[model samples]
Target: MKSNSHFSNSPFGKQKANKDKANSLKNLLPPLPLFILQPLLNHIVSSVAKKHPELFNRLGDSANKVFLIDPSDLPLFLILQPNPLNPTLKAYNQNEIIEHDTYICGTFATLMQMIDAQSDSDALFFNREIRVSGDSEAMVALRNALDDMEGSLAKDVAKSFGVLSKPVLLAMQKFSKNSGKENG
Candidate 1:
């Protein structure tokens, strides 16, 4: 009788390994809870407004209306409402604001990029990455505001997620590599 190989006999073992690898990758992704993040984002915007009021005015004039859509939520969108009359710079989540002429976007990263580039709205739209419904002028204005705010926006976003700490980010990367090794 010929000796059988242990590895060849168990197909389930390979499947389990694959599943574990997928789980590990899932765990490696940064934990970003939008509910907690929403307020932090608001604070960052307020901080930018305070630190550079001119930038805020530029954005306000250029992007009179803006919408942030959650990719996880698909059709649902979050509209940023910065009270023009209020000094405190309050941000509201009003559904009605979505009806206005605005730049509709899916993710914060993409939105940051839009604000940074100030002229990629058409590109994003062509790629189906962003969907704008009305007012080209408003879109242009929104882009300009993003340009003005680009300097501090990225840092503020990173800080909001606690990734501003280099050590912590490095540690997480190391942990992810180790976990990948174990899974492999």
Candidate 2:
């Protein structure tokens, strides 16, 4: 079986090939430069801070912690430092090494749904759809903070960017709903 694993018809072979193709495609696409993307990220955190001050407050001591949000399907990674006085979200290349208190890995849709309280974080983690490491207590605090809040954080995130907010938010909702992780 191992010797014939390269056969395209084999399930293992097909999965491997698809994984390789994904990785190859990822390498071909460079993430947007941080300098170019940082302003938008800044606006997101700032707007969220202003509109939902309780979010950081809910984070308690974890508010000072740094988080690396890694979306498996995207070519970029997001570094979130939700410090109350100086909160920030920044983009980085997938390979960029950065210091962070915690790492949250999942698909973009899953992360968004989790933030919006549309999906069960435990189910997502148990099912291996989302992987979290480091600062367990802080991660819990962050989750609790998001859960404690009302309203759609995702919608607020869209609202941070002017003009296309509504459509973008609708698209996000549709995307997450169709993402098929709602049960989780």
Candidate 3:
């Protein structure tokens, strides 16, 4: 019998295999320390708030409301409660769905792209690439806030890494470009 295993061992196949392995590794990671992550999250949000106060300003009463940002492709979720006084981030295991006023669900790439302002929020929502539930007001406010922001959150986020930021960002962009290519 001619071996059909050759196709399974091709470059595209290997890429898929690597992606599967990465997903598995991510699944195996232990629950991270919320306290350690909170400060970092706060800093990012604070930076954004400083740059565009209007976003948070629009939040009004909903500023204190907890919003769940769930990435459908990952085994984790993030809870964000925007506070003019103190913004914080709380991460949870996939199964630990907590009560929240608003929930924004999307693939990891879609969420990242949305946060980065790399794509149109309305288009993504209309295309069904993103799903929202619960508080529509809070969702609109948050989306508008992010959308109205002038700079790239992805760039700001990378800069948070200090010296390693450039290299990391480059690698990520290259990886994204490579992975996005169609395999013939």
Candidate 4:
């Protein structure tokens, strides 16, 4: 019998599937109020803070400044700042234009790659794949702090889930490798 794998694997089919997934995500992530979102962001940041105190400490002055992250594919930006009274971080939003002091703009995948250390910050900035504006000094400090990390933040985050961390990480790795092979 002849194989019909070619049909399901067609480029048009793949494009449509990707578009559908994107639409679904967009629908799911509709603008959320900061009050409702604060706890979740705090929890995630607290977990990271516990794992790496030095990282936050190294942020030092930079932590005092508000850093805005704009995911190119999303409608809103994320504002991150280290809590003044504690080591925890807080995320919130404000009006569109000048609400933020600095901006880190990039696609979600690009952000993930940065966190995973799969790509170099200098190269990404040079290629214009990621853009930073306003408060270049603070941005540099933030970048340096991230570059100094001992391991992938993505992996660290996965491992935060207790016993399922390993399995979840392995599955993510396998999926990433397989997807790369498929696209390449």
Cα lDDT of all candidates, in order?
0.45, 0.72, 0.67, 0.61
> Which of candidates 1 and 3 reaches a greater lDDT?
3
Q: What lDDT would candidate 4 get against the real structure? A: 0.61
Model 4 lDDT tens row, 49-90? 777777766677777766667555544456666543564444
Q: Cα deviation in Å at residue 57, candidate 3? A: 1.2
Clashes of each: 3, 0, 0, 0
Superposed Cα RMSD, model 4: 13.7
Top model number, TM-score: 2
Top lDDT model: 2
Instruction: Summing lDDT over every window of 10 consecutive residues in candidate 2, give the lowest-scoring window.
Output: 1-10
TM-score, cand. 3 vs. native? 0.70
Question: What's each prediction's TM-score?
Answer: 0.50, 0.76, 0.70, 0.66
- Residue 90 Cα positional deviation in candidate 2, in Å, after optimal superposition: 0.7
Poorest stretch of ten by lDDT in candidate 3:
1-10
The ten-residue window of minimal lDDT in model 4 covers 1-10
116-161 per-residue lDDT for model 2 (tens digits) = 8889999999999987766677789989987977788877888776
Candidate 3, 1-184: lDDT as tens digits: 0112433343323243234434654567666566676676677777776666777787787787777786655556787888878776767665452556666777666777787788787898899888776667778888876777777776776677789889867865765444334210
As for candidate 3, its clashing pairs are: none
Residue-level lDDT tens digits of model 1 in 14-125? 2332343345433354444457646755766676666556655665653334333322112223445444443232222222222333435434445545655633767877
